[model samples]
Target: MHEIQDPLFKPFALGGLELPNRIVMPPMTRSRASQPGDVPNELMAEYYAQRASAGLIISEGTWISPLGKGYAWTPGIHSPAQVAGWRKVTGAVHAAGGRIFAQLWHVGRLSHTRLLDGRSPVSSSAIQATGVNVYVAERDGTPGFVQASTPRALATDEIPRVVDEFRQAARNAMAAGFDGVELHAANGYLVNQFIDSNANDRTDAYGGSLENRLRFLGEVANALVEGTGDKGRVGIRLAPLTTLNGCSDDHPEITYIAAARLLGEIGVAYVHIAEADWEDAPHMPVEFKQQLRAAFPGALIYAGKYTAERARAALEAGWADLIAFGRPFVANPDLPERLRIGAPLNAHDRATLFGGAAHGLTDYPTLAGSAA
Candidate 1:
């Protein structure tokens, strides 16, 4: 590959912000937030600062409310201290000359009472995500994964409160010094629960038809934009084909195509599509890609098992404006530089992917050190 002419290195404008490259570090749940309050800390700052070379960094999924939290040690953006903690992280990233966006998240049916202070998890419908487990603290404070319990469906009046929570979280993200925010409307979370018909069994206006199903997502997107005071600073992520966390739509193409069109009408900054990456994963047809490109007026970002070659191909094809590297950014803090020079990458250690200290988080060496 000709490194000089690589599209990944080219600059692109995402709304009002000018990105130096097309590479994005999409959100990955590291589960490394500080104890007691689940706040951001200096260690997390160092981790993000180390990978500042990426054109953009979307933070790990953060809960918008106490009820939104689903995993152990994942951070929250609902409190003053949490906001203060994230301020340090944003400062570190900005000082290193990088831009960051907080990924606002709320896990609905994917939670256990252990994580919800004895309150049952809520979704658009009362459904249990079978065969799915969420990370939690054990009896002795050890980290473990437990099967999620059946969730309660939100009442019609309660829908507005959910929207308000997201609105408040967006304001909190701005107060925490983030450049922008991304809605985690994927992977069977609260927003995804509303979007996916299988997870949402409501007969009310928030469910039933595709249009009704998209109501919650539309409300949340508008809330985020209004709270942030900038439509260009807000982005929403959707997974059209992912079965992870038991999220599926009867007709993915119809559901997501309509979703893209709705988001385009909303005039948000961008739409991030999370592709399935596991072995034997279903393929996303070129036809769907074309339809999605036509539906969404804003920039499009694709993530999930993307390699340099595939990323380049996608950019050359003219559909994707940015490509996100999830696990690669976890191990290679200087991933952009490594890709630019075609240097070998450090393999990520799966054991320490979550709930660990700096050993697997920030201890990975750069190319120069590895060569030396």
Candidate 2:
């Protein structure tokens, strides 16, 4: 039998970025960016910099355009202020000897009119997203769900402009000194909407066949690669099995594998796959993941309720190149230290997961500091 090494402690090269370990901090929206339009702030910078010990930190989903926003307080990369704010974040992370990547996003129908710059939201189809957006709030300090604003399907003529937004966002990320950028093509967002049959009912070239359905995504990926100039500096993330927050598709396995094959052909740096987030929702089935692994020939990062032991298993099994920790890294800023020393893991507080200040965000202590 071949001896399998622990991927958790292994050094891997993601394009030009060298990660000391295979532990990645997957992008999680904190909803803490400045409101009106989620501009990156000092607090956000501190929050990410504090957790810089992870091998690679992928910043939270940031809108590439104002029309792409769907959540309150989530950051954007479309404006000068937002770009400046991100420069501060990258500077801090780089100062701390950490590598960071920005995840460019567009919420699509997952938004309400309140979140859009104007009262208009856009999608591949004129459908409303099925679930509630937790970011939109009521008058008092309580969480409420609003009906998703009706979305206007993207006209074939307008598709090129949408593709351009991704290209510009990638350029902006590099300008801000990020190591690279990840296209948020998963989680039923704008790109995902175009891939899902139920959400995309267009009759044009970008709609009917599988090739057409995947055209927008392919263009977006091609644009990012072209924008980056170096293939090793770009990655993409997909949630092919997420059935949460009102997201679903006809055949995720076939849809996503074909998508991965295309990315592999383009020679992307990496592909982050979120198997399943919601506890009750079905995860990326083992068979499906095997198929995706077979289809994609890049550094593969897996996220979703993963334990260090499981991460090791995945690496040993050759199923994943990296394991991304979400809530674990949130509570244990010294996650790499804890893993290295076999220290106890910190319990994450669910109450303060979103829409809050420093308590659960920045107050988590490192092992060395906590013991002292």
Candidate 3:
């Protein structure tokens, strides 16, 4: 197939935005925000601007508040400084003719007191995600990783306030010049904690049955819509089958199919599904994909370790409207162009993947430079 004829290069309408291609740069936490306040810095701005060739750029998981933070150096949207810091990033992307979205996130049970100012993390249930470690700042001001502490379940009345945090964060994202907002409701974060049955063991209205488990996500989705005043500019991400952060459900298809239907009914712009990408990961059944398409009317984005051929096949089969490239985008700033021309891609350095300087962040050579 001709490179131009590849489905990945085709244009598509994503809500109010008309993307030039179906290639998306999904959010990946690099943990490089400025110290003392977890502020987005010029380095981060430059990093994103370098990859502005993507059809849509979703910024790293940004904490909505101090309570939402799960790792050291991850940016936040709750403070004025953080907002100003991200503004530069959004401005940079827009100047390069790209659209960006802020991914609002809260780590829930996947957090430690060291990251939460000595307070226990909050979740739907008082459960500790065993065997999970989060990045943190050591006592000597060095970067380190620590096991997640046990979490305290949110009080029944506290749910509303938690929802409000998402609302406020959405407003902040818009103020920071984001084209839209994507709720980070996957990967065993706070919203994922509520959705997964294994993590949410409460008997309250926010737990037990699947419907109750969905209430938190629904409320948060609604809050983001209300805050943005435009449902078309809001989106949600879900990982129904992922056990990345100790999140699991008895019936992932049932849980996520219903969730997709709810998001479709709410009129969000898109639904991003983060597929399991690890070696030996279980395949997402074809039946589930068809059911999800029927349930959601908006754009559907699938991301994992998708090769160019696999992405084209998914688009050709009408299973996904867009394809997101995560790690590949990390090393190839001009990923769409690289994929278009079948150029060699730089392998990402695992050691410098997180909490790094410019060595692996913005220093990757582009096709033009490499040819020279």
Candidate 4:
């Protein structure tokens, strides 16, 4: 085994899993899953296995249920076919000796009527999310964004099913040969709906008080742990100060602090935090980020606008245990080696990011590989 000499290449443990370095390939939605329902495909296997040089790979957000899907062509972990599809992916990655995890997600109110089951996306309240769903199409073969529709509050009885969805997804992930699973409780998804006061205005056990609001997330995490059987293998992603897709909560400091502490108590493998949605995030102050670092008390993974240099700084500063590179990894399959040798990075093609063939997906070149 080659020992990493760069401070950024240092080995660390997220629970029982030992990473080769501190680099992480965060989840990026490619929308390439097979049509109708999101199912992993051979292309996905080739894409992920090609990038296995990273310390850890967190797969794109996979819907825990059909209703959890908010966009077109995203993958799901709910069905046997999906499981079989992912098995090909995991098998390829494992054959290359790469560690990977699946991120379980629910879009909550982000879904449009056109995207939902019977045109209903259940959330914590009836509030319409802020900002435009950027993926919406317009007339005349153009594209435009529009305000989100009002979401229905999930009934108290239906909440358990939501938790169960995550549990079952974790089970399916393991069965499909993933090393573990990560809960997509961040980024204004279903779990975030319950955490954000503006989104979750319920008068029931799942809302109001902080404890009540975090109840579903707690259940989901615990259930995933029980299902996956390796606490150190499971991870959770949280955007504590995200404003994208109109996600903002009152008392973010308190809510996130409490959440980090609670997640620590539950013994998850890692906590993936998107420091801020944007590069220069005005929402998350340094003090709040510091507080989260202190409260989380687990393997900390930070993603968003990070370079290898910044990743090294984060590790040296002890603010992040792992650094997840999003766009860089998208265009560079051998990202870790590129950073190791200070090579020029290929810029990602925005046009081909969402739905495309291997033209922009798996065709990115590595230093030693063909540039075809």
lDDT by residue for model 2 (1-372), tens: 554255587788889888988889999888787765568888888888888888999999989998888877778999998999999999989888899999999888888877665677888988877555536766774456677777888778888998999999999999988999999988889998888777788889888777888889889999998877778888999888786556677887888899899899989999899888665768566788789889999989999888878888888888799999998988998898787767999898888777778889999888878889
Backbone clash count for every predicted candidate, in the order shown: 0, 0, 0, 0
**TM-scores of all candidate predictions against the true structure:** 0.98, 0.95, 0.98, 0.94
Task: Using lDDT as the measure, name the better of candidate 1 and candidate 4.
Answer: 1
Worst 10 residues of 3 by lDDT: 1-10
Question: Which tens-of-lDDT digit does each residue in 138-159 have in candidate 3?
Answer: 7786678788999999999999
Over the stretch 206-295, how does candidate 1's per-residue lDDT look in tens digits?
A: 999999999999999999999899999999999999988998999999999999999999999999999999999989987898899999
Clashing pairs in 3: none
Regions of model 1 farther than 4 Å from truth = 1-4
User: In model 3, how large is the Cα lDDT of residue 135?
Assistant: 80
Q: Residue 174 in candidate 4 has what lDDT? A: 94
Ten-residue segment with the worst summed lDDT in candidate 4? 134-143
TM-score between candidate 4 and the true structure: 0.94
Q: Please tell me which model should have the higher TM-score, number 1 or number 4.
A: 1
RMSD of candidate 1 to true structure, Å = 1.7
Candidates' C-alpha lDDT: 0.93, 0.85, 0.92, 0.85
Evaluated at residue 269, the lDDT of candidate 1 is 94
